[model samples]
Target: MYVLKHGIKRNPEKRWALPDRIFFGYGACAILAGAFLEHPSLEGFYGERIIPGEGFSGNHIYATNGVIAFDYHGYSAREQLLEHHKRGWASRNPGWHCTIATVDFDLLDTVELNRRKMLGPDQYLHDPVPRARRFLRRIDHAEGAARALRTVTRSQPMLRVACTSDPT
Candidate 1:
């Protein structure tokens, strides 16, 4: 069984939303970043893996099912994840088969999946440049990431629910 973790961060006006499609399929272990699953048939084949880097920094433990189109806020991360998958996993897996969904936390919130629990949420909506820089600085840097992860677990919501991976 894959230990799956997925959620999005939402602060007042903005949210760091990850497309549902990113989680779909058997995710590979790219970095020592987190746990990943393997396909039964394709034993050696691992899915696309992109570690949080310079301009991007949102770490999520993936396993899943489903697809969705991109909107403005989620476009960058979505594009990066998709492009990697297209070049790697798609060619290897042929018919990529899997399904992924997020647990509904706040009915009022727009993003279905709340990832604040894992990578923490992005609070700088208005200041995009600062947010991007911070994401790179903190998430990419070892010392900064350790400090940030501590904050994420400490500030997590009271009641956190988890969902299983549905490898459709």
Candidate 2:
């Protein structure tokens, strides 16, 4: 209270705008920031997400049902949970899956399909830089799926050489 009186700070704006208007304005800007923050985690948290029509993205847990040109489409997180067929289970058999029960929550089917297919969506190879790649780079530094793809492409030749028993 003393600082408010004595400090050289500027006086606050005292216009009589409706509180609701301020609330709505802040709310809208927050939503927009979440929607297009470039980071998947940030964007997902801020915006309503839906899977694009092409289908599941290997890296993005929040794919929308329809595609927008860019910064135009949106979807809810619930849609992503449903379409992926994500499930909850341990590695009861071989080295197969990521044990999605921890992540899938309750909405999706959790079908025990091919593990690789689950980690990577159908359109994963179509572009040099996929949306999921950017999303991954923005979210987690450790297990970004896009980075994982690059590793695979770079190491494929080395792996084959090792498998073929090359001298060096």
Candidate 3:
């Protein structure tokens, strides 16, 4: 489940509006890649994610480890993620194609650094790392709480009562 801990801060009147919107994806991709890549089992990718029939495409980033992929949507099977995009785009634009062409993860750092240089002064893009970390912390805390609840539930014994028919 993807929890949107923050909302988009949009200001159409600002001169940087367009660029800020574009770089927001890049910043998010980089931040998620960085956060997930902190785990040794994951690998990160950065590139263009395309929805061919809809004629939509954009620079994207994600982390995966063969079975699962993580991005702004949180953890999901790669196929599930693709299917989600396909369904979403088809619903809006009537298309059934979705694919990703990834580049090296090393470029993410450079991309993020340049994104920072370009949009760092803007309030929307400032302190991306801290924001990402905070998001991670929230997820971790939630997961931990869930696990603790499950443990407590499991540890408790179930109650049972024998039913007897009354004889008159």
Candidate 4:
């Protein structure tokens, strides 16, 4: 689950699914920022292998937002996005604060688990692993990440204090 905070909104439906495709959108940077700033272990998750060339010529722009191991283009794109985001945010809001995290999930698997639970208690009680999985399950991974962001902010009391205090 990777929450995004940007200057513009692209998707009108807002209920986006996994493997969502957005043409000429800045969503890639949000994914990359999460991988870079927090989950270095899951950088590959941030990089999207598919590219849609028909709509936007800037399809190549997101190549760098992934890990080099998964896709070199994405790795480079991620670097560019990170630098650009930091610089841009700094210019606009000198005291800009942010934290990023992506909670990778298998949507189909989650749905299946939920279905099993709904069918019978025996299905869920059969395994402790299912309980763990259910605990982590989220209706929307990005929204889950947004919840995590709140948890993060709440846990860091110092961060709250620092945010309010004058830098000088």
Best-performing candidate as measured by TM-score: 3
Order of candidate numbers by TM-score, starting with the best: 3, 4, 1, 2
Q: Give all TM-scores, in the order shown.
A: 0.21, 0.18, 0.50, 0.26
Q: lDDT (CA) for every model shown?
A: 0.28, 0.25, 0.43, 0.30
Model 1 agreement with the true structure over 31-118: per-residue lDDT tens digits: 1111212221112212222233233332233222212111111212222334444345334444443222332233112242133223
Q: What are the per-residue Cα lDDT tens digits for candidate 2 across 15-83?
A: 112132231121121222223334443222322222222333212233221211112122222322322
Cand. 2 Cα-lDDT = 0.25
Better of 2 and 4 by lDDT: 4
Clashing pairs in 3: none
Candidate 3, lDDT over the whole model: 0.43
Ranking by lDDT: 3, 4, 1, 2
Model 1, global lDDT = 0.28
Model 4 scores what on Cα lDDT?
0.30
Which residues of candidate 1, in runs, are more than 4 Å off?
1-76, 103-168
How many clashes (backbone N, Cα, C below 3 Å) per candidate? 9, 16, 0, 13
RMSD of 4: 17.0
- Which lDDT value does model 2 have at 41? 38
Could you tell me the C-alpha RMSD of candidate 1 in Å?
18.6
- Give the lowest summed-lDDT range of ten residues in model 2: 159-168
Per-residue lDDT tens digits for candidate 3, residues 51-145, read 14334533245555433455665555555555555555456554344445543334236454365332232234354555555555555533533
